[model samples]
Target: MAATPSASRKRILTYITDDSNRKTTFKKRKKSLVKKARELSVLCGVTVCAVVCSPFREIETEVFPDEGGVREAYARFKGMTQVEQTRRKYSQETITEERYEKVKSKALKVSTGNQEKEMTEMMYQYLSGQLMSLPAMNLVHLNDLAVVTQRHLERITEKLAALGKEGDSVLMPPPPPRAPASMDMGGGMRNDEGNGMYVNTNNRPEGPAC
Candidate 1:
């Protein structure tokens, strides 16, 4: 058996169930942690510390930058206000986790928006006689569409509230779609300007204006 190239390989992290393997992993990781702390202190001239304790026994297993250095750093850290201390967490793992949270939030927002847009299409299909009745359609889909519609209404309410605060007049609703002229208007789809994005279909021609 041969090891795969690092660049082309993806390593999956998992818990080591075997006691011996777990112990070995802990020792190796502890050594690596201390080395990284030392390197960072030397390269950046910063007071950095790494402490690895024995999980099996009550004892200090390893400490980087010496005991005196660790004590001084600890004392300084404790002297700071609670608020300041809370804001000073800049560890690599902490920073990575924070960035991951932000990215996750953005991805969720995009997913929600896309879902709402798709649901809006479904709503139109239901209204325009392009699909089966609600009873025949999936209940889950109907629920999703209702939720999407509610969100739309909430957004409109928020915008209206903001405008009210600004003393601005409410905007007029958009004009209704004009009936497709003379070309045998029937329940069918038609391409829009060569772009396959949206197709307008009507059930029947609009009645004469009252």
Candidate 2:
């Protein structure tokens, strides 16, 4: 289930059009805003002040904590070190942009991982004789599989080139023999009739691998 977005994560924000409603909204938002600033100041031991210009002509400009507080905060800000100034000046837009980039990167990684899994599953299905032909798959899946296969071949080629003929023995050493389940112990070959996979039992098993 998708979680409902919080008030802070509002999808769209616009000014209230109705005069009465706008006035009411302004008052409520201003109160909450001032409350938050006060809480931040008290909790974090920070010097904070808010100055709100009133939309209603009757009401004068509003300053949270008061004019003295604003002046004091301004003086402290001016006296702050460059590092302190930098820490305080990182804007909402900067924070939002960073979060967006992180989310985008994570999403891309997940998408790539899922695509690889799907293509691998398709390849295994074809090899196991579950899928008879390429025509059985959709255009998109077929294209993705082809691309994945090409890349896989390219990677293998790169590895083989790097390793040269020296590591040819290491690349695909030999398949281990499976014990005879039903047939007699002739130390012969085992053919998987279902998938057309063959296993040679003449060679001894090597060190730890499948």
Candidate 3:
């Protein structure tokens, strides 16, 4: 007598630890599970929801292919989760705001207290002559220092200008010859001589003028 297929096939759950093996097993199991779920839902005509978490805590969903039923279930689940998350977030924000206000108030109070203490010390020093004991400390002394500094700055500027002028004097070119009174044209100068003969300065004859 031949053994039946069901008798040979063992229906037992096995955990796979190897990365590649786990992935292969997960794919096969997921397909089989979804197929079985769909078959059951169609055969029994019942609403079903299935959620699976892999070993890595990643979630996977397999719903009966009924569009309306899947959508309704998803909407309810998502709506509830969103409401809870929003409520928790608002509560956190309220607590944070209260803490911030408390910290801000304390900081202001401490800062004001420090400022008052400093002002009191400064007033006491001003009333006594302790502030005047230091030489060159008063406003008049400061003004005198500023005037002396300004005068020193002016002297330095004058020295720099004098040095620059001396440098320019050393680099000076020879002065050009003054033109004759007749050659001087008030608004425009003519290239030709007043006698109408053109004088080519560039090609001048190598002899003294007659």
Candidate 4:
């Protein structure tokens, strides 16, 4: 049979007894208190500011400097009419509540209209069973098809040239160079990975990459 082990014992002690431990505790508690203050400011929609000074004279401060709460409290406490007047002027010039609501409503209406139009078109296409079929010729689609044809032609010509090279008796015609952008119906514009149109020429843009 194995012998039984002794039970461990622990005791509670004050943190401030050791100077190093006291300092460490103070640092941790200060950080926790600051975090709690920030959370209170966000959750309760209030502004909070806290300042701490250690025994060695180091000082730290945290401020919630948002629109309401502590700022209003301080303004009221100090009877700062000038500050209130400045705030009112800034708000009027930069962003008024009325203008914000108007812009938001306009954006919402435009987005809803676009979504409805897309949904109606999709439903019509599904019911007609013509979603997969290409219908009604357009300049843009024609230009895309031309580009695809040119790519396939180049591939076929390259294969023929390779075969001719491998068997010296056969001579293959050289593939024609790609047509200039101006000749394409797309007016020199190419689809850049579906993001937007771009000029197909070799010339680089002036600015840095987006």
Candidate 5:
């Protein structure tokens, strides 16, 4: 028993000026808008601020999941405005080009520093082999590693088979872990072991032949 779709769906547009209906629509839309705003902020993990004013009410409504999120968003917006205002003021006042350049240079340095810091952290992790730790890898990341490994395995197998006849000393390497022949890209992993969508690299075939 499933619910059926509505026969008459409401079109989204400006509500007509019927006082009673408009009030009802405003309340409904306001609630929906606030819910959507909260959901968007949560899903994207970003600060979001939505201010709503109704003609019927004296107080304005602000929608934010966190108490400080609205303040932070407002401060960021104000900072941008102040920066643009300062830039415009400096341009109009015939400030020395060197001073303006210094301001721009400082901003660029700040941006570059942040990027360099992130890159340095990643490089340190990679060099130290800390990045190989898999507790933090999501399903999508794991799946991608699996696919890359499968392709590499195929290449190695083909090369080994081709060069096996070249010399008696040319040893064949152990075969790679068996993965599903085909997998649904949308799903994680699929195989006989019912391990879901995650490719299990630990399930290496027994006995090293190479």
Candidate 6:
């Protein structure tokens, strides 16, 4: 028969005091914790970081999804908003200088036609939510946008004019004017001497009075 397991097997939560045994247990538990954290992150599509402090030495061990994962997770844990983090990233001296150089290079190559293309691209980028990192637009960009819009309007007007010339639309004449209300008593009056006058039929007698 197999040897009966000890009480420690039944109670895995209790501490093991033996120096060598404790070290072994510590290594095993640390490994288990790291593995569980990584599995959880992968299965749930989440960010996870596990930190372990050395039992004997003054050192720390950390497990993360990637090199920069720890820093990103730490920032979120500290309640930093996405905008704040982005600002912090671009506000660095080196980053700002790099961004300025890139903008200058791009500006040197831009032409009149490219201005229209850039404006269209900027509109699409905004629609796609990719303009979060872009700098605030200036007056020049606004002018480009206005030019593009005017060109589009001109094209639409030309198409409408061509369609109209093709007789694709029917023009309906204005409705006939409504007849004037009757003024004669009990009957409509007739126009005499080109003047509109009415004589009441009820008041007229059989014979004319002198």
Find the candidate with the highest TM-score and give its number. Answer: 2
Q: How far is candidate 2 from the true structure (C-alpha RMSD, Å)?
A: 13.6
Error of 1 at 73 (Å): 1.2
Which 10-residue window in model 3 sums to the lowest lDDT?
Answer: 184-193
Badly placed stretches (over 4 Å) of model 3 are 1-12, 54-210
lDDT of 5 by residue, 83-180 (tens): 67566454534666766799899999997667556545554576589887545666865565555556656776788788765333466576665555
Which stretch of 10 consecutive residues in model 6 shows the poorest summed lDDT? 188-197
Please give, for residues 1-210, the per-residue lDDT of candidate 3 as tens digits.
899999889776566669888877887888888888878888998755555546544535444565677787677657776667567455767988988999999999997667556544544565586665434356864564455556656876788687776545656897755554346343444334455333445455579768
- State which candidate has the highest lDDT: 2
Clashes of each: 0, 0, 0, 0, 2, 0
Model 4, residue pairs in steric clash: none
The better candidate by lDDT, 3 or 5, is 5
Query: Model 6 segments beyond 4 Å from truth?
Result: 1-12, 58-60, 80-210
Over the stretch 161-202, how does candidate 4's per-residue lDDT look in tens digits? 877654334455666555544343355456444433346644
For residues 1-210, write the lDDT of model 2, one tens digit per residue: 666667458566577789999888888888899899999999999888999999689767889789999999889988989899888576879988998999999999999899988897777788899988655667887888999888877887788778775446767768866544444335666654433455676684777875
- Tell me the whole-model lDDT of each prediction, alpha carbons only: 0.76, 0.80, 0.65, 0.62, 0.66, 0.69
How far in Å is the alpha carbon of 124 misplaced in model 1? Answer: 5.5
Tell me the deviation in Å of residue 134 in model 2: 5.9
TM-score, per-candidate, Cα-based: 0.48, 0.52, 0.26, 0.26, 0.32, 0.31
| Candidate 1 vs 6: which has more lDDT | 1
Residue-level lDDT of model 1, residues 63-95, one tens digit each, is 877889899999988999999898877887998
- Pairs clashing within candidate 3: none
Count backbone clashes in candidate 4.
0
Q: In model 5, state the lDDT of residue 34.
A: 89
